[model samples]
Structures are given as structure tokens and as C-alpha cells.
Target: MTLDTKKNVFVKLGKFLGQFKEENCIKNEAVFGNDLFFEKFIDLIQLSQSHNGWYTPEQVYFSIQSWADALTEENLSQWLSHYDFSKVKPKKVALILAGNIPLVGFHDFLSVLITGHDVLVKTSSNDQHLLPFLANYLIALESGFENKITFVEGKLEGFDAVIATGSNNTARYFEYYFKDKPSIIRKNRNSIAVLNGNESKEELAVLGEDIFRYFGLGCRNVSKLFVPKGYSFDSFFEAIFEYQDVIHYEKYANNYDYNKAVFLMSNFKLLDNGFLTIKEDSSYGSPITSVFYEYYENLDDLQKRLEDENDQIQCIVSNNLVKNSIKFGTTQKPNLWDYADNIDTISFLSII
Candidate 1:
């Protein structure tokens, strides 16, 4: 199929997704194929938690809305305009998806297919349902997609290249196994925020969205903070208090209780706010219901350190204190063009 054909299909898929927001899922009769897929999609969203406890309705709906906002004709055109597809030859790109958050791997899936390659997906067991359902919807919009998408349950093979996302441990296995193939093997990375003690309460409140969205499972979620020396946590804690309801979730509460106990037993001092805890540590990756913080003496030194250790970091959150830092509260809502790990997937695909 032509690029416009493929793009149009996704635009339709986006419109279908646009109907199912967290506030209300109103059916739009103008959307194609909704008669058969609309109600079923709603049921799937509601039941997603059964498959993965972290896939709460609120989280799933937020993901849906984000995608709905992204898959527009204008956004797709702007993102694709940077590439030359006329000379491209279709290849099979195998994707090993990570299911930590709802639809976490959708961007890679979209990238492969939108670039005119066939996709062989190995969906993470934690996220088995949502993508396939959307694939079916895409196929319904244009029968041509049926030939381009495949779900692999066994060992992945017969792909010209691969894209895999996993923890630091699994990434080693991927590198050794797919060493011969053209691949993008992603490893564990965490996001951090740099605080200057001058942020307004409103910015800090939205920063809570960055911390609590997806319960801090996404790589883009801020898991650590860099604050100035002698900076007080009073205002920061007060601003984020709005998200305390997250503690009501049993899974998060259990994590809070367990990690808090472990920290106390280890003789580590913690700053607790009844729901979330902030500990002084150097690690970028923090557990759920908690965030690690470190004090920095100078922005210049911290910038150099972050630059030198870029691989371990996913994205930075700040009031532009660091170069290319993402604004507070928008980390989880990445643009279609924002390549993960700062590696351009389209450029990689174009060469392959």
C-alpha cells in the first residue's frame, strides 16, 4: 500500500481511539468500523487490569488519549516529512515489546509499519490484548495491513532486523543473540528532574503528574531529582500532595509499605509524605511510590555529569535548567518524533 493509504488507516484508528477518553467514551458514528469495534474496545479497556494489575482504567485511558492526540494527519506528516521513503525497500522488523505500562511499545510498532516495513511483534505478556486489537482495527480499515503485521508466540525468526526493549540484564542477551542482525536493543534507563528551588507551585503540581502517571513505570517518568544544596522539600511535597490518592491502590500501597520498611531497616533516612518517600541516593532508577533525590552544587557540573552518563538516563525534566530537558508534567506524553534513548529509529530503519 502507498504511504498515504497507510497513514489514512492510522488516522482512522486514531479517531476511533479518540472516542474512548477517561472522562467519557462517546461513540462518534462518523468513525469508521466503530459499529463492530467500539463497544468491544471499551470492554477491553475496562478489563485490561485483569491481565496486568498496573493497567488501571485511568492509566489505559490516558494512554489512549495521548495516542489519539498524536496520530493526527498533521503530526504524522510533520514527522514523516523529514524522511525519504521513495527509495525504501520493505524489510521485516521484529519488535520485542516491554509491557511495563499500557501500550509502552506502540511507538516502535508504529515506526516500523509507518516506514513501510512489515512488522513481526512479540507482545509482552503483560500487554497482549491492546495492540493486537488495534492491529485488527487497522486491517479492517485497509486489508493491506493484514499482510504486514504478525504476532509471534515462539522464537522470533525470519526478520531482516530487530528492535528490542528490556532491562539492562535482558539487553545483554539481546546483544549477544541479535549481534549479527541490524538491531536497536534498548536497556534500562530512568528519567530525572533537576530542581532549582524556584519553580512555582503550579509547575510542581503538574510535576506530580510526571511522577504518578503510569505509577512511575514508564521510562519517561521522573524517578529521581537533582535539587540545589540546602533546598527545602516543603513546597515540593505540598504541591505533589494532590497525587496522594495513588496510595489507595493496593499494589502501590504494598510497594510503599515494603520499600519503606526495607529502607528503615537499612538505616537510610527518608523524607516521607504518607504516600511517597524521597530518599537521598545517587541511583537514577527508583522503585514505585518512592523517588531518589541528590543535591547538586552547580548546574555546570551536573550538566557535564548528565552528559557523560547519558546512556543511563532516558529524559530529563526541569524548567530548562539543563539542555533539551523536558518540561515538567509532560514526560509521559512524548511526541511521535521524540525517539527513545535519543536514537533515531527512522534513520536506523532507512539505512537498513
Candidate 2:
């Protein structure tokens, strides 16, 4: 099969994805009502809800849309900084898909696709559906992309370079197994927010979107916050309160009861929200049913602390005009430009 230059790959891939999102691509005459073909994400959102997390229907729609858009060659081209792919040679690649959030496999999939390499995906059972669906759609529009990617449900085997995303515990296992291979074995990362006094309530509400979207399960989700000591909790709550309707009271109430009991048994205290529980911890990300936040007395001290822990943070959200920064409203939706690890993926592509 001839490799289409990145230019052609981008355009065709975009067209294919655009076509895929439209309602007509699906054909299930047996069931005429709202279909999971597009709405399959409701299952994901529901699974998340069981753990007391939040996911609006719109958020799920957009999340799937995000996956579709990012997997395309057009998005991949932009991610590679519009580099000409005709210049690179195909590289061998193995990608261990992460099930932590929706479509987390996309980055690795896009990287391999744009680099003109074969991708072998070891899918997580919790999150196996999307990537295979995507490959089939790509096959429909661009057989080359279809043929270039492969999906497997088991452990990954041989490859020149492997990229694995898993919990911090699994990183050591990945390292031990793939030591002979050039690999990017990523450990768990949590995104954080460093709030100053200037951010308005509306912005904070948008920030809530990030925390609630995907139920704070994604690596890009901002879990910890650094609000000014005197910052109004009311302002922060007001902004985030718009999402209150999504509080899945039953699930959250249960978790609240369970965790509260555990805390009581262990002699712990948590500020309550009728459903969600908030506690203080140095760790950024928490389980869907929990949120741990620390109140800092000084900006300089907070900055020093964040700098020390920067390696564990995938993105930093703030409303302040900090370039390359993940601001409040923007955390849930990352553009084509925000590369994981801020690595110049195109530069890597240019090399091979």
C-alpha cells in the first residue's frame, strides 16, 4: 500500500471523521430509538456514575467527538506541527491503552498513525470499544489507515518502541518487561490548578466542568487546587454549582455514606456536600467519589511545592493569562496542540 503524504492523509482522515459523526453512518433498523452508536458513551457515563462521579450527556457527546477528532490524520498533522511525513520512515510501535478515562489510547494511536508506523494496541477490557470502532471507520474511508493499525485484547508483544500508560504500580511491571525495547512507559499523572485571587466565578464554573467531566477520571482532569487563603468558597462553589443537577444523588450519597463511615471508623473528618466529600491531601487526583484539596497560606510556598511535584502533573489549570497553561474552562477539552508531556511529537516523527 502506498503511503499518502501527510497532506492527503490529513484531509481524507478529516472527511472520514466528519462523516462518522453524522447520524447517517449508523444502520440499525431493528432499534429505531436513540442509539448508542453515537450515544454508547452513556454507558461509560453511567459506569462512572456508579462511583459517584459526574458526566453530563453533552460532556459524553463531546468526549466521543474529542476522540474521533484527535484520531484523524489532520489532527495528527497539527500535533506534529504540520511536518511533512514524506520525510520519515515507518517505525515499529506498541501502545498499551489506558482505561482510566475515555479514549486515552488516542494519543498513542495518533502518534503511531502519523509517524507511518504499525500500531499494536493492547486494549483494556474496561475501555476496549472505541479504538476498534475507530479503526473500522478509518478502514471505510481510508483503507491505508485501517491497515496501518491493529487492535488486540491481550498483552503487548514485540515492537521497536513501546508506549504504555498505566497506574504507577504497573509502570515497574512495564519497565521490567519492556527493558529491551525503546519505550515510553507512563506512570499515573494528575493535573492540578494553581489559583490566584484574580479568577472570576464564571471561570471557576468552567473549571468545575473539568473536574466533573469524565468524573475527574482523566489524566488531564485538575484534581488539586491552590486557591488564595481568603478566596471565597462561595465563589468557587457557585461556579461549580451549575453542575449540581448532575450530582447523581443515589451513587454519590452511597459513596458519601460508605466513605464517611470508613473515615469515622478511622477517625477522619471530611467537609460534606450532601453527596461528594472533600478532604485535605497533598495528592492531587482522587477517586471519582472523592476530592482532596489543600489550602496554602503563601503563594511562594505553593509555587515551590508545585515546582517540586511538576513531573507528576500532566497539565496545570489557571484563569490567568499563562501561555501553554491549562486554564480553568480549557482543561476538559485539550486542542490538537497540547501534546502529552509537552513533547515535540513531530520532532520524534522527523527523526525516524
Candidate 3:
């Protein structure tokens, strides 16, 4: 199929997704195939929690809405305008998806397909249902996609190249195994925020969204903070108080209780607010329900450190405290052009 045809298929998928709720889903048949697929998708979204405890309706809907916003004609055109795909040959790209959050691997899936390649997807067991179901919708929209997409249950085979997302340990295996193939192998990375003790209350509140959204599971979630020395977190704590309801979720509450006890027993001093904890630590990967914080004395030194440690960091959230920092609360709402790990996926697909 042509690139325009591929874009049209996804735009329809986006419109179908637009019917799903960030708050309440409303059926709209104007979206392609929604007359038959819309209500069923709603059922799947509702049942997603049963499949994975973390895939709550709200989270699933949020993921859906984000994609709905992104897959617009304008967005797709702008994102693709810079890439040259004329030399692309039809090749199969095998995908190993991550399921930490809903549709975490959708971008890679989209990339392979949009670049006019077949996709062999190995859906993470934790997120098996959603993407495949959407694939079915894509097939329904474009019968040609039926041959273009495959979900593999066994060892991936017959793919010209591969894109895989996993933790550091698995990354080593991927590198060794796919070392001969053109590949993009991703490793675990976390997002962090740099606060200058001069942020407005509203900005701090928005930062709370960055921390707690998706229960701090996605790579874009701010798991660590860099605060100026002697900065008082009183206002920050007060601003994030709105997300206190996250404590009611049993999974999160259990984590909060357990991690709190472990920290206290370890004699690590913690700043607590009943639901969230902040501790002084140097690591970027903080545990769920708690965000590690470090005090930075010099902006120049911090910038250099972040530059040096870029591989471990997925995003930086700030009010321009650091170069190319993501705006507060916007980490989860990445544009279609915002390549993960700063790797240009389209360029990789074009070459591979």
C-alpha cells in the first residue's frame, strides 16, 4: 500500500480511538468501523484491568486519547515530512514490545508500518490484548494490512531487522542475538525533573501529573528530582496534594506502605506525605510511590552530568532549567515526533 493509504488507515484508527474516554466514552459511528468495533473496544477497555492490574479503564482511556490526538492527519504529515522513504524496500521488522504502560510499543509498531514494512509483533504478555485488537481494526480498515502485520507466539523469524524494548539485562541478550541484524534495542530508562525552587504552584501541580500518571510506570514518568540546595518542599508537597487519591488504589498503597517500611528500616531519612515519599538519592530509577531527589549546587555541573548520563535518562522536565527539557506535565503527552531515547526511529527504519 502507498504511504498515503497507510496514513489514512491510522487516521481512521485514531478517530475510532477518539471515541474512548479519558473520562467517559461516547460512541461515534463516524469513525471507521466503530459501528461494529466501538462498543467492543469499550468492553475491552473495561476488562483490561482484569488482564493486567495496572491497565485500569482510566489509564487505558488516557492512552487511547493520547493516540487519538496524535494520529491526526496534520500530525502524521508533519512527522513524516522530514523523512525520505523513497528508497524503502518492503522488509519485515520484528518487534518486541514493553507493557509497562498501555500501548508503550505502539510507536515502533506504527513506525514499521508507516515506513511500508511488514511488522511481526511479539506483544508483551502484560499488554497482549489491546494492540492486537487495534491491529484487527487496522486490518478491517485496510485489508492489505492483514498480510502486513503478524503476531508471533514463537521465536521471531524471517524479519530483515528488529526493534526491541526491554531492561538492561535483556538488552545484552538482544545485542548479542541480533548483533548481525539491523536493529534498535532499547534499555530501561527513567525521566527526571529539575526544580529551581522558583517554580509556580501551578507548575508544581502539573509536575505532579508527570510523577503520578500511569502510576509512575512509564519511562516518561518523573521518578527523580533535582532540587536546588536548601529548597523547601512545603509548597511542592501542597501543590501535589491533589493527587492524594492515587493512594486509594490498593496496589499503589501497598507499595507505599512496603517501600516506606523498607526505607525506614534501612535508616534512610524520608520526607513523607502519607501517599508519596521523597528521599535523597543519586539514582534516577526510583521505586513506585516514591521519587528520589538530589540537591544540585551548580546548574553548569548538573547540565554536564545530565549530558554525560543521557542514556539513562528518558526525558528532563523543567521550566527550561536544562536544554531540551520537556514542559511540566507534558512528558506523558509526547508528540508523534518525539523519538524515545533520542533515537530517530524513522531514520532507523529508513536505513534498515
Candidate 4:
């Protein structure tokens, strides 16, 4: 396709996705029943309790809005700070997804669709409703969309490039299998925060959203925190206490109890709010095991620690760190320019 074609694709997609409301996406994601949109997304996150690849409508809304916002200059700029966009282009692509997080594969799907390439996607069973459901919604947005996209459940042959996401272990498998193909193999990554004691009740409230939204189950979710030595966990805990409503009955209760029991059985030291466990560790990504937090002596040490662990860092959710940086509610939501591996997604699409 030509540049005009690519531009037209963007025009159609923007118009379609721009007007998209939660209700529409709710219908798309639901199997049946009253619009359980936010509830379903919440269930997904609650189910994140078991690493079952779920999400609730509220979280999905946060994610989709983040997705919508990501296409433009605002969110994309922070991403572009580290990537080069001049080389992006559309290429025949195959995307294999990870079932760990809700719509973990959608970023690759959107990149392929918006970049003006034919996309063959294999959905993760944990989130089977996502890409196909999103495609159904995006395709219905306009005529060209219906024509531009295809849904492949298993696998596809003939591809110039590949984009796949999985556990670090699965990433190794992806590398060995796709070694000959130009690809971006996204593996496991953990996000964090370096609170400098300036956090107010309002900011901590939003941080509460970041941690609990998906039950601390996203790559962008700060499974850990980096506070100065002797940092007060009380400041953060007080904010989390306000969200006491999220812990009602059945599944979430079962998850809270099960994980809590495991922690008790193992004698793992933890700071508990009767809902979340703030344990300290150096691991990335929460496995429904427990949320880990760490402390740093100063900003320089924090920067060095993150830099040294760049391979394991996905995103940093903090305020007052940089001008246009991400806040708590915005984690997991990525912009178009925020390409995986800091590579320009659109430019890559335009090139090979």
C-alpha cells in the first residue's frame, strides 16, 4: 500500500475508535447478559487473582482510553523519547499472544492494523474475547476496516515479520522459532515507582488504582515500589484503605484468602491491608503470589537500579519524575509511539 493508503487507514481508525464508548466495547467483549462491561473487566482482574487472564469493564475502559490516547502526541511523546519512528512500516505479520494479562496482545494487533498491513492474529485463550472482539468492533467501525483485517485462530504461513508476547521462558521459544524472521519478541517485564515522600493523598489514591485495578496483574502494574530507606508505607496504605469496597465475596475473597494463606504458611513477612500484600522483593511481574516493594537510598541509586534492570523494566508509573510521565491510573495503557522494545512501531510497519 502507499502512504495515502496508510494515512487513510489512520483516519478511519481514529474516527472509529474515537467515538467508541464503553458500552460498544462491552457488547463486543461480553458473551451474553446485561452490560457487565466494567464488572467483567473487574472479574478479569479479580481472576488475575489466579493468573487466569481476565479484566473488568472499568479496567478495560482505562486500558482502551489509554489505547486511544496513545495514538496521539501526548502519550506517544514519552515513548518516542527512547525510540526512532522514521523507520516504521506495515509488513505481513503474525502475532502470538500471552494469556497472562487482558489484551496483552492487542498492542501488536493494533500496530499491525493501523500500520496498514494484513494481520494474522492468534488469540490467547485467557483473553480470547479481546482481539477478536476488538476486531469485530474496529472492523464494524467502517468499511475498509472489515476488509483490512483477518482473524486466524491457530497460525499463519508466509510472513515478513512477527510480533509475539509471552513469558520470558516462552520468549526464549519465540526467539528460537522466529530467529529467521524480523521480529519483536516481547517478554516478561515489571513496572515500578520511586516515591520521594511528596506523594499526597490524591496521588496515592490513583496509585491505589494502579496496584488494585487489575489486582496487581499487569506488566505496567507496580508489583514493587522503590522508596527511600525508612520510607513510610503508612502514607500509601492509608490511600489503599479507602478502596475497601473492592473486596466483596466469592472470587476476590477466595483469592485474597488463598494467597494470604500461602504467605502465612510460608511465613513470608508482609504488610497487609486485608486485601493486598506489600512484600519487598526484586522480582518483576506479580504471579498472584504477592506484590513486592523495595527501597532505595537515593534517586541516583534508584536510577542505576532501574538502568541495570532495564531488561526487566516495562514502565515506570510516577508523578513529578518527568514532565509528561505516567500516573498510577495510566499504567498498562500504552500509546502508539510507545513501541515495544523502544522500536518505532509505525516506522517498522512502513519499512519491512
Candidate 5:
């Protein structure tokens, strides 16, 4: 199919997704194929948590809404406008997706197909249902898509290139396994926020969204904090107190209890606020229900350190205190053009 044909199909998929909200799922007759797929989609959303405890309805709905907002005609045009697709000789692009958060690998899936290439998707065991469901929807929107998308159950072969996302360990294996083929192998990375003690209570409160959204499973979730020396966390703790309801979730509560016990047994000093714990750690990746924090004496020195270790970080959230940092609370609401790990997928695909 042509690029415009592919784009129009996804735009329709976006419109269908827009009907489902956290509060309600309102059906619009104008959305194509809703009569067959709409009710089934709702059922799938409801059943998501049963399949994977992390895939709660609220989290799934948030992911759906985010993609709905992203796949608009305008957003797709802006993201794809920078690439010249004439030179893209259609090839089979294999995707090995990660399932830490709902629909975590959709961007790669969309990227491959929209560029006029066939896709071989091996869905993460934790997220096998949602994408296939949407793939079926896409096929319904355009019968031609049926020929372009395939879900592999065994060994992945017949693909020219691969894009794999996994932990640091898996990345090593991916590098060796796909050594001969062109590939993008993603490793574990974490997001961090820098605090200057000048942020408003409102901004701090919003930062809680960055911390708690998707239960901190996403690479975009702020898992660490950089605060100046002698920084008082009273306001920060108070602002984030609104998210205490997270502790009511059994899985999260179990993690909070377990991690807290481990820390206590190790005699690690911690700042506890009933639900979340803040520990003075030099590391970026934090466990669930907790965030690691480090004290910085100089913004310039800290920026330099972060730049030197850029591969370990996904995003830097701040009040523009550091160069190229994103604003508070917007880490999870990334635009279509915001490529993960600063790697341009389009450029990579264009070459391969």
C-alpha cells in the first residue's frame, strides 16, 4: 500500500480508539468497523488486567488515549514529513517488543508498517493480546494490511532487519543473534527529574504523575531525582501525597512492603511517606513504589555527568534547569516525533 493509504488506515484506528476513555466508552457510529470491533475492544480492555496484573483498566485506557491522540492525521503527517519514503524498498522488519507497560511496542509496530514495509511481530508474552487485536482492526480497515502484518510464534526468520527491546542482558544476546542483520537493540534505561527547590507545589504535584503513571514500569517514568544539597523534601512529599491511593493496589503494596523490608534489613536510611519511599541512591533505576535520589552540589557538574552517561538515561525532567531537559509531568505524554533513546527510527529504517 502507498504511504497515504497506510496513514489513512491508522488515522481511522485512532478515531476508533478515541471512543474509549477512562471514565466511559462512548460509541460513535461514524467510526468505521465499530459494529464488529468496538464491543470486542471494550471486552479486551476489561480482560486486560486478568491477563496481566499490571495491565489495569486505568493504565490500559491511558495508553489507549495516548495512542489515540498520537495517531491523528496531523500528528502522523508531521512525524512522517521529515522522511522521504520513495527510497524505502519494502522489506520484512521484525519487532521483538517489550511488555513492561501497555502497548509499549506499538510505536515500533506503527513505524515499520507506515514506512511501506511488512512487519513480523513477536509480541511479549505479557502483552500478546492488545496489539493483535489492533492489528486485526487495522486489517479490517484495509484488507491490504492482512498481507503486511504477521505474528510469529516460533523462530523469527525471513526478516531483513530487526528492532528488539529488552533488558541489558537480552541486548547482549540480541547483538550476537542478529549480528549479521541490521538491527536496533534497546537496553534498560531510566528517566530522572532534577529539582531546584523553586518549583511550585502544583508542578511538584504534577511530577507525581510522571512517577506513578503506569506504576513506574515505562522507561519514560521518572525513576530517579536530582536535588541540590540540603534540599528539603517536605513540599515534594506533600505534593505527591495525593497518589497514596496507589498503595491500595495489592501488587504495589506487596512490592512496597517487600522493598521496604529489604532496605530496612540492610539498614539503609530512607525517607518514607506511608506509600512511597525516597532513598539517597546514586543509581537511576529504582524499584516499584520507590524512587532513588541523589544530591548534586553543582548543576553544571551534574549536567556533565548525565551527558557522559547518556545511554543510561531515557529522559531528563526539570524546569529547564538543565539543557535539553523536558518540562515536569510531561515525560509520559511524549509527542510522535520523540524517539526513544534519541534514536531516529525513521532514519534507521530508511537505511535498512
Candidate 6:
């Protein structure tokens, strides 16, 4: 019923999740209620791929590890320290989750509940299993959560506010339909990186993680690159060569073959390294197997251009080259305070 109570439940949940691994899963008896839920959670993480091919054990484990790190008492306290939640009045907040990657909609779900609001979640069909499993875990940890969470199977109704994530098209529909309600409606956005050609091989290799993690399915994954003119692709290619194993995944391999064929048929010049393709283009949204690139003439001009088009961008990954840019390999491991779309969900929930 209180914030500390909620935080304790998640901390215990985090401890439970920390036991699952791809190579060896170790059960921690100190974790409460593990007898009933621990093995089942491990089974769900292992079988996630059967529900959606994209949810492979490696990918699902990465997501679980990220959450395990985030739900610590120290991190949760620091994240919540910035906000004043004493004035929050309980309201039902409707959430429409996006399932492009594992746990994509979890931050919103966590924000709504941690701020003392009742959450009405409409889970994406692709991600129906994981969150509900966590919700049940939370309830088992503390029965109070049972009244604070609800999953909708049909039309959503009787909510004071809404937060929805989807494509630009679906966002338009949400904007029109929820015009009368207070809301945060998110649309498609992509991340990019700027390269001055001085990056070390290690830095560039870590950048490959930003590109290839989650099979490049997440909004935080770097989908585009900005390089100075005359930049060579040789070093960049070499740095990411280790991730060539990604091409062995059947789904990613199929996409690689299909998108590469289409590019070749269209006479588009490409820089290929077997597993990933880099194409010079002005667009931010790239296909799953490829990343778009553009050559910038001046850093200042490019900065202004990115500022002008800020709404279309989710994050920028660079070594202090762009304003508010994230460090290499750190985009996917966002802190609790790293609000999506630069919008403060906690502040939004507190006021509503």
C-alpha cells in the first residue's frame, strides 16, 4: 500500500529473476515464495521463444538481467528520490504495451504502479506471458498488488489517463480516440550514432552491441549512423565482425537475405559484412538486418539538423559528439529515470 512496500516486492522479484541463466540456473532460497514460482519463471524464460521466435533464451536472459540490475534498492531509491509522490491521488491508468522486443512496455507498467495508480494493462499479444507472470509474482509477494493491477482482454474503459506505444499510424488513431483523456501516446522512433573516425576499435566493437542487441528490434538500438565524409567502412566492419554469429539465427538470417536481395535488385550500393548491411540513406527507420547511414559535412550543421528533427529520434549514441548522447553499449541498459520520448512518466502520473 506504500511506496516502500511496492519497492520491496520488486526487489524480491529481482532476486528471483537473478537466478535464471542460459548456462546455469541457481536457485536462491532466501527469495520468498520461490517454491511456487521459481521453476515456473525459469521455464517461461526458457520457453519464451515458442511464444515468439524473437524471444530466444539469450535475448530473454539479457532482458531479465537488465531488470535484475535495475530493481535493486539503491537504484529504485535514487530514481524515486527526484519526485514528490505525496500528493498523488489514486487513478486507473490504462496502458497499451508494444511487443517489438521483450519487456518493451514494462517501464510504463512500473511507473504507473510505483506512483500509486491502478494499472489497467492491455498486453501486446506477442508479449502476453512475461509481464503477467511478473504481476503474479508481485501479488504473491504482497497481496495488496492484486487490487492495483488489471489486464484487459477486450475494449479498455473506465480509466482516468492512458499511455500507449505503437507505430505512427496507430498513434494517430490513439490521439483521436483518446483526445478527451489525459495521455502519453508514443510513436515509432529510432536511435543513431555519430562517428568522427577517431573511435577506438573497442569503442566501435561495443557500438556493435548497440546495433545488434535484441536483433536490433528495440527503439534504443542504434539504427542509423552519422559519419564524416570520406570515412572508411573497413574499421567499422572489422569491429563488428564478432557479431557475425547473429546471422546464424534463422529469423535474422531470413531478414538479411530478403533485405539484401531487395537492395541489390533496386541497385542500391551497400556495405556488407555477411551479418549486417550498412546503406547510405537519409532515413532513420532501417530494416531489421541493415542500418542506414549518412555523411555529415559539419558537426554544427548536423547538430542543428538533429535538433530540428528531435521528435523523430529516440536516442543518440556517441562519445559527446551530439547533445545528450548516450555512451556506446549503454543505450539498452537504461536507468529507471531514463524516461522514454523525453517525457516524464512519473511526473505525469503524479499530476493525474
**Top-lDDT candidate index:** 5
Q: Model 5: how far is 76 from its true place, Å?
A: 0.7
| Error at 325, model 1, angstroms | 0.7
Residue lDDT tens for model 1, 128-158: 9999999999989999889999999999989
Deviation in angstroms for 289 in model 1? 0.9
Clashes of each: 0, 1, 0, 23, 0, 0
TM-score (C-alpha, index-matched) for candidate 4 = 0.78
lDDT of 2 at 149: 79
Off by over 4 Å in 4: 1-53, 68-90, 137-148, 319-325
**Residue-level lDDT for 305 in candidate 2:** 74
lDDT of 4 by residue, 1-352 (tens): 5434544444444433343455554333322222533344434434543544246555555555655555543433443355443566545788887765566676677667655677877777777665565566554444576766766775667777888888889999999999999888888777777687788888888877777666666677777777778888888888878766667635566777888888779988888887777777767665453567887776766676677778887778777563224777666555555555555666666666
1-352 in candidate 6: lDDT tens per residue? 8899888888888888888777788888888888999889888987899999999999999998999989899999999999999999999999999998998888999999999999999999999999999999899888998999999999999999999999999999999999999999999999999999999999999999999999999999999999999999899999999999999999999999999999999999999999999999999999999999999999999999999999989999998998989899998999999989999999999998
For each candidate in the order shown, give its overall lDDT on alpha carbons: 0.94, 0.65, 0.94, 0.65, 0.95, 0.94
CA shift of 71, model 6, Å:
0.5
Worst 10 residues of 4 by lDDT: 25-34
Give the C-alpha lDDT of model 1. Answer: 0.94
